[model samples]
Target: MKNILITGASRGIGRATALLAADRGWSVAINYASDAAAARSAAREVEARGSRALTVQGDVTDEAAVAAMFDTALDGLGGLDGVVVNAGVVAPSLPLAEMSLERLQRVFDINVLGSYLTAREAARRMSTDRGGRGGAMVVVSSAAARLGSPNEYVDYAGAKAALDAMTIGLSKELGPRGIRVNAVRPGLIETDIHASGGQPDRAARLGAATPLGRAGSADEVAESIVWLLSDAAAYANGAILDITGGR
Candidate 1:
């Protein structure tokens, strides 16, 4: 079975991807920042799906921790074929003038910088030069990147927008070496991320704005992620898949 590492697998879309990938027979390393219990529980679901599962703990923003997490995960799985950089945080909803530098940095640190750090390490380890299979890296971005969420959390949108730019560059840099890099921009997904931004009703409101007139489930986003890593997407590289229900 192919081995994949999914960051922030303790809850929300990351957890959903772990379950889906495992159910489809992919060995999963569920990385959690602080929720060991949740990670273990998710691991059980993976194991139940007849796939190997390992629970790892680390902060994606910390280079040393990220490095160790990937090392431990690869060691447990014997190899890695893919990585999903799904862990992120939303800055509190506020006007740009009211947003503190600390808040902006924190959001960028975890959402943009964290993905960069983790993806860099995953690329190094999973590169063919390391006697491993060339792997795919999927970043979970947000539609807010394009929507700009100016009235609420522009910082959050900017962070995701930066991620899109990173994926574009990384894809080109690594594509020649057989590594694929891509991103998923999900819109109005029913996830706890909104709650973290101090607006638990944001998703619902945004959903109503969508052409589909409903919020998407975490599993819906996970399905897109699973496909991007599958052989079915062999020709897909550096693709920015928008999962919005027709914005």
Candidate 2:
């Protein structure tokens, strides 16, 4: 069985991925930020699905905290096998001209800088050349990366676009180290993220226009993330897949 760590796994796509990965017999170490209660509940759910589970608390933007999260996960799981870079945030809708510096910093710091730090730690731990077994990495990007998210969240969009580039570069860099890297750019997923961005009904209102005629579920995105981490996608590398329902 595989052992995996998923950042922001207390709820939303991260939580869904953890549960599904557990269902497939993967030991899961879930990382949550400022939500001990929710993390505990998520861990219980993972255990119910017949997998070893642990929850670690950390803010992904902190380098020290990211490293500590990895250490805690490795200690709890006994090894490293996979990691999902899923922790991120979205701010209120605003045009690029109207956005504040603080907002931009928070968006990029978490989405771009935090993601890179988390992925770097995973690479360091799971690299075969580093006295560890090979592993897989899945970065949760967003449709905003490509769509530009104009007049809404250009900063968040730009951050994800940087992540997309990072995913591509890391795939090549880690491939030689025995880590497979891939990314999923999810579109209009029904999750708490919309609410956090100050528009709780955004997905519902926007999803109706998608070709699929509805918002995608966190479970839908989770399925692809777990697959990319499995041997089924052994040959898949540096791929930026879009789960946009043809939008």
Candidate 3:
């Protein structure tokens, strides 16, 4: 079975992806930052699907912690086949002029730097040039990357935009080595992330304004992520897909 490690798999899209991937026959390593209980619950769901599941706890922004998470996943799952860089954070909505440096730093540190660390480690373990089997990687970006999210969390938008650039560049850089890199930009998905951003109903409110007329579920986004990691998308590389329901 293919082994996949997903960062921030304790909840939201990450949790949905873990369950779906396991149901599709992939051994999963569910990584979470602070919610050990949630991570274990997700792992139980994975195991309930008859696939191997492991819970790995670590702060994605910490270099040593990231390395340890990957190490534990590799040792537990036998080998790595794919990874979903899904860990990210956002602060309360504020205009650029009012945004604090601390908020920006925390956002970029977890979204940009964290993604870099996870993708780098995945490359080290999956690059054919390094004598390991090739693999796929999916970065969970946001539609804010393109829409710019002007007055609301522009810093988060900028960080996701960096991931888009990295997806394009890394895909080409690693293509020859048999690795595929892609990103999914989900818009106004119904998840607790909005609550953390101090807007518990943001998805429902903004989603009504979208072309689809409603908010998306975590499962909807998870479907796209898992498909990109599967062989069915063998020809899809360096693609930044928008799962915004036509928004």
Q: Candidate 2, after superposition: displacement of residue 180 in Å?
A: 0.4
How many clashing pairs per prediction, in order?
Answer: 0, 0, 0
Cα deviation of 101, candidate 1, in Å = 1.7
Model 2 spans with C-alpha error above 4 angstroms: none
Q: Work out how many backbone clashes candidate 3 has.
A: 0
TM-score against native, each model: 0.97, 0.99, 0.99
Candidate 3: which stretches are off by over 4 Å?
A: none
Query: What digit string (tens of lDDT, one per residue) describes model 1 on residues 140-225?
Result: 99998998998688998999999999999999988877789999999988999889888899889879978899899999999999
Candidate lDDT scores, in order, read 0.91, 0.95, 0.95
Better of 1 and 2 by TM-score: 2
lDDT agreement of model 2 with the native: 0.95
Whole-model lDDT, candidate 3?
A: 0.95
